[model samples]
Each structure stands twice: as C-alpha cells, then as structure tokens.
Target chain A: MKKIFDFIDLNAEIQWVIVIILIILITATLTFQIWKKVKPSNLVDEMMLRTKSWWGMCFIFLFASLVHPIVTYLGLAFLSFFTLREIYTLLKLRDSDRTVLLACYLSIPFQYYFAFQGWYTMFLIFIPVFLFIIIPFLLVLSGDTTDIISSMCILPTSLMLGVFGISHLGLLISFPEMNTGNISGKALLLFLIFITEANDIMQFICGKIFGKHKILPNVSPNKTWEGFIGGVICSMIIGYFMGFLTPLETLPLILISACIAILGFMGDAIISAVKRDFGVKDMSDVIPGHGGYLDRIDSLSTTSSPFFHLIYFLLLA
Target chain B: MKKLILTLIYTVFWRSFNKIIIGLKYHNHKSLRKKKQFILIANHNSHMDTMAIMSAMPSKYIHRVHPIAASDFFGGTKLNKFLMKYLVNAILIPRKKANSDKDIDPIEVISKLLNKGRSVILYPEGSRGTPGVMSNFKKGIGYLIQKHPEIDVIPVYLDGIYKTLPKGTSIILPYNCNIIFGKKIDFHSLEIDDIVLKSEESIQKLIKRE
Candidate 1:
C-alpha cells in the first residue's frame, strides 16, 4: 500500500478512493437498470431514482473533496445551513424566534471558521456553550414566552446537531499531521463517509432481507435486531480492510467502525422519531429520492463528531 | 440597457436568493417558459411575491414581464419608486384614481402591455393580507382579462412566501416557498364575475393540493 502511495504521487489515496466511489456508483446504476428490466415495480422505480441521486451526490462529493479545502469547507457549511433551515422549517418556529433563528444561521459560518482556523477549543464550545446561552437570551428579548420552552429546547439542539456536529468533518482537513504523503485528512474524511454510507446500505439491505424482529417499533419500524448486527459486522469488516486510509490500528479501526455503525443507526432512529412526531414522512424533497439534506446526512451528522474525537484521542493526542 | 441590467440582476442575484436563501420550489412550471404573453395572477402576501414571480420567469421574457403594483404603496418613496421601476420593472398604477380621468387607466396600462406582447403579474387580492389565508380576489383581474380576451390568464399559487417575508416585517427569514403555476384559463365566453370566481377557485384548489 505504501509502495502504491509512493508510486502514484501525492493525493493518490484520495484519487483511488474517488475512482472506487465512481465505480461503485456506476455498478449500482447498472444493477438498478438490469433489475428494473427484470422486475418492474414501484420499488424498482424508487431505487432507480435513488441511484440517480447518488450519481449526482458522488459527483459533488468528488468535486468538493478533490478541489481546494476551502471548497470543502464552504460545501460543508452550506450543508449545515440547509439542514438547519430544514429543521427550523419543520419545527414551525414562531415569528418571534426569527432573531434566534438568524442567530443560529449566523453561528454556522463562525463554527466552520473555527474549524478551518484549527481552533478546536472554540469549535467545540462555540455552539454548545456560547450560542446555547445567547440563543435563549435572544428568545427572552423577544418577550413572547408562549412557547419559549419549545424554542429553547429545539433551537440549541438543532444548532448543536445540524451545525456544530457536521463542522467537525471540515476540521479534520485542518489537522496538519494528517497531511502525510498520499494519506491526508481528506482520505480520513472519505473513509468515514464511505463506511457510514456503506453501513446505511448494509443495514437497509439486511433489514429488507432478514428483518423480522423489530428493534424499535415505535421509533423506526423497519429497523430490526438482525439488520443492526449484520450491518455493524459488515461495517467492521469493511473498516478493517480500509484501515490503511487512517492512522489507526486494525483492532481500533474495527471497534471504531462498530461504534460508528451503531451511532449511525441511532442517528437515523432519532431523526425518524422527529419525523414521526411531526407527522412528516420526509424532512423535505430537496434531494430527488433522498428526501432532504437532513434526511440524507442524519447518520453523518451523528457519526462525524464521535469519529473525529476518537481519531483525535488516538492519533493526535 | 435598463432591461439588460434587470435581466442580469434577476439571473444572478434574485435567482440565487430565491433558490438558496429562501429554498423556492416550483411545480407544473415547465410550460411557463413557453408562454409568450400572459397575465400571471397569484396570491399576494409578502413584498417578495412580485420578485419571486419575476425571478421564476425565463431571462428572455424577464425584461418583458411587468408586475402591476399600487402606486401609493410601492411608490411611497423615491428609492422605492426607482427600485419598482428600474429593478422590478413594475407598472405602478394609482389604486385611488379609479374615477380620475387625468391618469391613465390601470386596466389600460395592463392592456397596452399585453397588446405589445408583454406579460403582467397581477395579484388579484390587490394587497398583502393575512399570511396563509386567501381573500376574495378583486374584480380588477376579471375586468383586465375581459379587455384582452386574446391573452391567456395563468393562475399561480404562491405558498410560504409569507413566512419568509410576511406583511409588517422587514427581516427575511429562510423558509421553503413554493410557486405552482396552474393551467391557462380562457375566459372568452365567461362573465367577468365568473372569471373572478373561477380564478380564485383555481388558486384555492392549488393550495389544497399537497
């Protein structure tokens, strides 16, 4: 692996990963096409739309990853902004909450800016600490306490998850030590993304095939114990093989992959419960088949921070 | 040159703001570009309504599209008048001068625009009202369509713009807004009252859909 990395040039791992991703997307598209021809149904049509969206997403991911780090930061920041917007829209926040909502949006750029500047202390505490107090203060300034408790709870938590949580991925790129030969922070970022997405697909496939016993019937009816276990194990295996992408050892990588898989499921379940409570099937139809930015990045939003911290403790510390 | 600047602004700034900041969505709008000259009637709730409608049009027709605005409201200040005239390309008509013989008739201005193969965006509700609630569309639209029987009338349903920039608010919040264009209705044989009622019904039906 080191020989191949040395032979190709800098960013070889990232290039190889992009190539692999493209191949996977093309395979998925071809498989969907063949499957549709063999068995045409609403399910197939939906799957085809999903695969088409994946193609678009892959192209974007490739562009953002291969381009300048500033582009990746901007893309991540915009994603955070849109997901937060989607959450705010669903919460049906009052007009009085507009100041707090704008505050929430204004915090997104600063959060990502902290990450970009490698101010880990500021990035970690910005939204959860400072904005937590300031948001409620702004809400109180409005003096409309009719549903103050709900806004108080929803605004901070949404900002924490949608903005603070996702900005960690951008922070990964700023790690100076992660830039070594063909292995850079981009590879690590892509590794986490690929594993999280793979785990989602694995769990979904396992659930459809072997999902009999419900894991959480109230929160996510489709989730099953069998699917969860199968997905984690599969992700662990994939993570072990892809351990070269990161600086971690095999055992830690496998364990961390399992943690990510479990956390991803939890993330999906949490968002699912939010949707269920709101009586919404999807967050929004921004993405053609993936529902919304929030719907697509729910798992990533949850898994990113934990993954970043684990790597930080193991390698950086 | 002013028309060119308007199209440039619409294409660059206004379109991005609508799509990115406000998250505007369109439904059944494929045929909107094919429309050469038509009257677009939509529900008014926000100051963003006219800009949103104009931004959604093809840049080729953007210079030719004029949103009819009440002079008293939009022409209150010199700055607002400049923006309404130059930026928005709106035809400001006096709402209180219906009986005045001196001023050009509001319907006549709209008819002249339509006669010259230009499109006009008319809010049948006349003014911004309660958010998410539809009031009775005034008979002005019915009268305008009656004069230009050859022009097609497209009923548009705008949802969630009020949430973004509702009445009595200058702060623009980010929200998902929808613009649904309905099929063109020909009211050649229908009575003016029927046209008014049918146009309202058409927009109301669009609101109930999804």
Candidate 2:
C-alpha cells in the first residue's frame, strides 16, 4: 500500500491541478447560473450539461490519480470498454462478425491487464499481433465465409482505436519513472491529459469565434486554419510550462506539444471521417450532450499512444 | 406465489439480462402509462421477445398484464406448463388439438380475460418467425380484437430479438434488442381483416431495420 502511495505523486503539481479544476468548476457553475437568467438558448443547456459532466470527470480522475495507480488503469479499461461498445453499437455488424466483436470486447481487459503488469512488449503488440491472429482464426472456425474480408478490415481498425489506442493512456501512468528528474506517474499522466484536452477545448472555442475558412470542409467542416493555429499556440505554451509536472526539458515538451496538436487534429479528423462514413452525427448518446466516450476522446485515441512513446524514448527508454 | 415468481422472472431476471445484452432500447413507454386495459401485439422472432416487452411495462401495470402463450408448446409437458404458468403468467391458447382433446377456443379465453380488465400479450404471427423477417398475420389476433372492440391494441415491434436468440436455438447471443411500442389502435367497427392489416402495418413502421 505504501509502494502504491509512493507511485502516486500528490505533490505541489497535482495540488495546482486540483485548484485549477475547482476554479473552472466554480466559474462554469456561475456562468451556467448567469446564462440561464440572461439569455438561455438550447445551446446553453447543452453547454451546462457538458460542464456538469466535466466536473464529474475531473473529480473522479483526481480521486483515481490520488488513490492508487491501479484505479487509473482500471478506470481507463472501463472507458475503453464503453468506447468499444459504442463503436460496435453503431456498426451494422453481420452475423459472421458476432464472434469477432466478442473477441474484440475481450481484448480490452487483456490489454489493460498487460498494462497493469508493466509488460510493455506485450502491451505494445497484444491487439495488433495476438488478437489479429486469434480473431481471423476464430472467424474461420465459425465457417461463415460471407463478409469475412470486410470484417477483418473493420475489426482490427476498431479494436486498435477502441482498445489498443485508449489503453495507452492507462499504460502511460504505469510506466516506470526515470531517476534523472523523478517525474511521478500521476503528474505525467495528468500533464498529458491536460495538454491534449486543453487543445481540444481551445480549438473548439477558437473555431467557433474566428473560424471562417474550412481546413477540411468535406471531412470536418468546423475545423479552420485560424482555430488550428490558435489551439497549437495555446497548447504549446501550456505544454512548455507543464514541463514542471514532467521530466522532459522545455524543447522536448514543446516538440511533444506540437506532436499532440497535429496528431490530435489528425486523430480527431480520422474519427470524424469514420462518423461520416457511417453517416452518424455522433457515435452514441452515452454522454448526454457530448455524444459518446468515442466522441469525447477521439483526439485522445490518437494523442495518447504517440505521447507515451515520445516520453518513453526521451526519458524512460 | 404465482405472481411473485412471474414478476421475479420477467421484471428482475429477464429485464436485467436484456438490459445487459442491448441496454433494451425501449421507445414510446409513455403509451404504457394509462391504467386502461389494452392488448399488446408484437412481432415474435425469439422467445426473449415476450420478456423484452414485459420488462418494459411499468411495475404497476405488470401484475395485470398476461401473455397469451401457445398451449401445444408451452403446455406440452408438466414442467413446461409449470414454468409458463408461474414464470410468465401465461394464459395458454391451444394452437393444435390432440386426438382425444377438444379444440380449445382461444377467442373465448382472451375475451373472458380482457372483460376481467386484464391486459393480454398476443403475437400476430401466431409463432416465432425468422429474426428480421415478419410472417403473415394469423386470424387469431384479428378474432380477439374483433370480439373485444373496447380493448385498444398496442402495436410493438421487437427488433433484434431474432439475432439475439433466433428460433430453434437455445443459445442466447448478447445482441442488442429494441422494443418500440407504437400508438394504441382502436378501430371503430369490428372488422378482423382491417384490424389485422392496420395492426401489422403499425408494427412494421416501428421496425427501423430491413
């Protein structure tokens, strides 16, 4: 239990996170009250609901980060399960794909289990290599030849995004810290999430305020070059200062922030492309106004993997 | 004792299981809010279809709701009869008669139950069909509605039940199921053909899938 406590960093850095969250929650609640009195649009209620959920998310994350490392891992595993369920729910799966879907759902727990064990080698390739071989073999055994190729194509990509991609965030906290600067697991995980999510919110706000020219009009019409630049600039500045929470130097943090900005956009765009292909406005209404977990974490699905690898290469590796 | 077991199976056990499988997407549950008795007509594909609908009914109304089960199948054996009687509160309607047995009239039984202010469940298809495909409506439902013109019919579409637990298979897959209850149909004059066609058509619209 003490070792678990040692792994978690409830230091000045995390204290700052709690303060910031409190400020944001208070400000959001006040704004909701004021906006309800002044000019309440349907959008106001939606924004209010988003803020409410954000408070829930922030507190739960803080508690998990403070309690033990295992909670964070299991929390992420739970998120991946819901996200995977959302993906499969929207997909018009064939009868042949039933076994494959079940296999994909089962892979989530195994991936996180590996993450918990700190089996980096197995965690990195479990879904892509292990489940990749196992699923197709199971499909062949089922004797349903129809829709096999498409099932093979969709299953791996969805699992990679829904299971493998999201589980990296859990793995991030479990990675061994280097002795050079002694950056704690909770602080690093919090920092990565902060930058990635801040980038998302900043982009949406900037896009709504000043966005005119569409970056990818066909794919994500809401995205604009103005919003993109603004989000990158804001996120980079935050990432540069958040170096205190991480072991990386300013230059490396800057580079990582840039990667998060571009990759986050690309990640979000790729999921937008998927939603477009499926002709769904959002994945599902699991998160009330925010659609589903997939809708909220589309950027995280892309950002977490590369960010973890970058940290690994720079410090721990 | 009978109602207790029936409520336990339908309300607690099957409801939880179906909720896990599909989250049991129930639509127009507002239609079930009224205290007035109405017959529920649904498309039958899997055995789970009945429970799926029963689970969605409010607890206040569930005690008064009785499902009309096929007597030949559900009442064929002693154990099957016990389960159907207690677990489902099923009022068995004979589909086929034995050599020595008399032809049981389902219309008489259904009318008697409806007159007693009890809501009944009926499958217009008479039996479970291939999941995702609807069979032609039998005259049994038409006869019931024609006889009891005062009882409104609630058309329900049990989507994905076939995929979850198709006919001739006991293996229950965890496929998501949706129960959509359409508006109650109260035909003015008693016409079996008109009531059956309209009831079938109403349930068809509730199905979003092909």
Q: Give the i-RMS of model 1 in Å.
A: 0.7
TM-scores of the candidates, chain A only: 0.95, 0.92
- The CA lDDT of each predicted structure is 0.86, 0.79
Cα deviation of A55 in candidate 2 (Å)? 3.6
For model 2, fnat equals 0.07
Query: What DockQ values do the models have?
Result: 0.75, 0.28
Model 1 chain B scores worst on lDDT over the 10 consecutive residues at B95-104
Off by over 4 Å in 1: A2-9, A180-183, B28-30, B100-105
After superposition on all CA atoms, what RMSD does each candidate show versus the true structure? 2.2, 4.2
Docking class of 2: acceptable
Query: For candidate 1, lDDT tens digit of each residue in A113-184?
Result: 898898878888998889889899999999999989989999999987798778989988896666655447
Question: Which parts of model 2 have CA positions greater than 4 angstroms off?
Answer: A1-11, A32-45, A59-74, A176-181, B28-37, B60-64, B71-79, B96-101, B115-117, B133-136, B159-163, B166-177, B201-210
Model 1, residue A266: what's the lDDT? 86
Candidate 2 residue pairs in backbone clash: none
Shift in Å, residue A145, candidate 2 = 2.4
lDDT of 2 by residue, A1-317 (tens): 12223455557777777677688789988998799889989878988898888887788878876787788877788778777777776787776667667777778778999988778899988988988888888888878888787777788888888888778777766665531357666677788788988898889888988898899999989899989988998899988877778877889889999889888888899999999999988887667767878888899888888888888788866
Query: Model 1, DockQ value?
Result: 0.75
